[model samples]
Target: MDESTGLTIHKSEAVALTQNGGLAKAIKPLTKEIHLFDTYVAGVSYLKDKTVLQEIKIKDRLTLQREDNKFDDKAIVVLSSDGKKLGYVPEKDNIIFSRLMDAGKLLVAYIIEIKKRSIDYQQISIGIYLVDF
Candidate 1:
């Protein structure tokens, strides 16, 4: 049963689950963990180099931390590969992602694509992957 989409998919019917349209569609079996949905980034000003964001590796691992200082109750800090401050998880999409991260779920983020936009939040986009044990 997937919590996000509320779809119950048995392990034996994983293939049919994907065909039936659910979170299973986003899932891919990779070893013991399932590769789940992707997450995005916001607050571009905190990024080290907005101009060079596109240069980041596509599948490079990132870090997520709970931030309660000046943001929402679900604020999640998105960090770079080398432990630098990249930005944050977008507010609208941070709820589930933050909760999952805080619950000690193995969630991973990668640099998917970076769009050069005038608005800050519209700048860099990060891809989120989940691994459950």
Candidate 2:
């Protein structure tokens, strides 16, 4: 059963339930990802190794962390998978996402497109998704 969309799985598509109930206990809750918005990563020019941007690819997952101490109260810092600082979610776009984070919602970002104009100029577009279980 998919709770988010109220969709039921046909028996043919369902996993068999174990008689011992161990499988039920091991089953994880299903989660649905809702795309909230897409935006470019801000301040990429400030990264130490701009060349690292070339290594990023479409559909790469990124991490978003709230920076409460930042000058902008709504700051959300974006990071690469290996913990590299990849700039921010852009000030104009962080308010709603920051609020959702403050309210304990699970949010994720993924690279949707990467356009490289030169060694010094590149644009990373990411899509933000809300993970609902």
Local distance difference test scores for all models: 0.70, 0.84
* Best of the candidates, lDDT: 2
* Model 2 stretches with alpha carbons more than 4 Å out: 1-29
**Per-residue lDDT for 10-49 in model 2, tens only?**
7532455544574655454566789999999998988986
Q: Residue 15 error for model 1, in Å?
A: 36
List the pairs of residues colliding in candidate 2: none
Q: Give the clashing pairs for model 1.
A: 39-128
Residue 35's C-alpha lDDT in candidate 2?
99
lDDT of 1: 0.70
lDDT of 1 by residue, 82-108 (tens): 767778888888888778878787676
**TM-score of each prediction:** 0.61, 0.75
Identify the leading candidate in terms of TM-score.
Answer: 2
